[model samples]
Target: MTTNTPLIELTAWMRGRLAERVARLIDAGHDPHTGPDLIITPLGTTGEPGTRADRSCDRCGRFVSQGCILYMITVQAAPRVLCVGGLCGACRRLEDGWQA
Candidate 1:
């Protein structure tokens, strides 16, 4: 359990960053759900660590090719910590007012 503290902290930090970005987008009159400029850092994997492979975007259900950037999202819904891949960078930044 203690070994996972760092990963948990990292996840929390990432979530906070996402929240801030979303707030900024909202203030700018943009819909965050339609933007892909948000950064998604991959935390520790649910499978073997350090192993890389192609994955699908959990949000849009699109296949993400290898070498493409995939965002890692961790959702805590009580009694469960669901980790899933989010949109690819291009898809994530498709909306106006997206930074980066």
Candidate 2:
């Protein structure tokens, strides 16, 4: 299996977990619409080329300098398209378990 396969599965599992959490909240008589919004966004991959001076790495929370290579992560769920954040090269690899 490819590296992306596991990441994809992990995201799917997270979606299920989110659903369960929402169900529990509803069962406890909480107003669904009043509760915090639940969003399931897609994972970002490394190797894409981009640069952002004002963005921080989503995983490591480190600021990337201007002209530095960064990865753009976009999450798509139904009608929502969230352009989450950029990931530094190191964090991006670590996120995918590509680093030891």
Candidate 3:
């Protein structure tokens, strides 16, 4: 019989890694509230420390200014307090591993 190649093992490992990441995000997504990592920018307002809008993409980790896929992460204590993108569709695709 022909031997299975290392490619299969690599693919499996990659898939497993990706699946774990997705699962973590899903759990975070299922959270009902969010309030961490805020920057509250306006001196003393809830908007001051800023929000996840202040954070960047989970993939590229940079400021988003293109109105792309905004991931709603609810893993804290307030809703609408986090985001992942204003990325262009291309970058968004990349963030999603080109297949999300």
Candidate 4:
């Protein structure tokens, strides 16, 4: 028999992991209402190109410079604040193992 998890299951798993991560961020002083609201969108979706300067990877705390591929997460508190959290390329690739 073939061994392949369904796409739906993989998607759900990713979402759950992301939720847990966000919760951890909140617990680690990244609370949306009390701290900067991270507004993470796709790289191109932000109407800009390449990665943001001086933005570190929220997952591993690695310094990320421009031109590097990144996956960002957004933490928001409505009309209060907006900021961005990110994961460097290495972390992003590592996270891919979550599907397994």
Candidate 5:
């Protein structure tokens, strides 16, 4: 639990990032809202201490060779949604999981 960093600011930042991420998905011919969550885990960032999660679409699930987008959903903890595209990807041999 990293202290000294406010949670609100983190969440707000996450929201903005998430918004952009979803937008990028739309640009890449994918539905942001429809993408299924591929992974969920507590974020371990040094500064951005929030909930970092992973998600992907059907095609992305197969085509994506890296890890799922390293995104943080802090709406409940903070107030924003942060999603970084091309951040992470999923693994096929891992059995329904990502290595973010």
Candidate 6:
């Protein structure tokens, strides 16, 4: 269980960062949601991770082709909310349902 502490921390940190960015964009009257469209497609229900050429996992910086599973991570820092995708399978496994 202790092994997952770092991953949980990293996930929280990433979410906080993303939330801040989204909040800033919203305050500036810009639509932050549309920005991810060019980088990711709508979340799929194929029960398997999708592939994206030339893209690296947002968490571990690994190539998606290297068995990385894409995920739509929800970021909520306050009134701002958004979802960011891209996390490797290894990292996801390490999480093991311990995500907050």
Per-residue lDDT for 1-100 in model 6, tens only? 0111223444564655565566666787766444433222221122244444335555566666544345535433333233445556665654344433
Give the clashing residue pairs of candidate 6, or none. none
Q: How does each model score on TM-score? A: 0.32, 0.41, 0.25, 0.35, 0.28, 0.43
Put the candidates in lDDT order, highest first. 2, 4, 6, 1, 3, 5
What's the C-alpha lDDT at position 66 in model 1? 70
Runs with alpha carbons beyond 4 Å of true place in candidate 3: 1-54, 65-69, 72-88, 95-100
lDDT value, residue 93 of candidate 6: 58
Write model 2 residue lDDT over 6-49, tens digit each, in one string. 34432443345345544555577654443344443323223344
lDDT, candidates in the order shown:
0.44, 0.49, 0.35, 0.47, 0.33, 0.46
Scored by lDDT, model 3 comes in at 0.35
Best-matching candidate per TM-score: 6
Once fitted onto the true fold, the runs of candidate 4 whose alpha carbons sit more than 4 angstroms away are 1-54, 74-84, 98-100
Candidate 2: worst-modelled 10 consecutive residues by lDDT: 1-10
lDDT of 5 by residue, 1-100 (tens): 1223433333343445445555555676654343343222122222232322223322123222334343322222222223223222332212123344
lDDT of 1 by residue, 15-98 (tens): 564455456546767554443343233332233433333365433456666777776545432121323445566545532125
Residue 71's lDDT within candidate 3 is 49
How do the candidates rank by TM-score, highest first?
A: 6, 2, 4, 1, 5, 3
Which residue runs does candidate 1 get wrong by more than 4 Å?
A: 1-54, 90-100
Query: Considering summed lDDT, which 10 consecutive residues are worst modelled in model 1?
Result: 1-10
Query: What's the lDDT of the predicted structure labeled candidate 2?
Result: 0.49
Report the C-alpha lDDT of model 3 over 1-100, residue by residue, as the tens digit. 1222222222343344344444454576643234343411111112222465443443344544545454432211123222222333544454345665
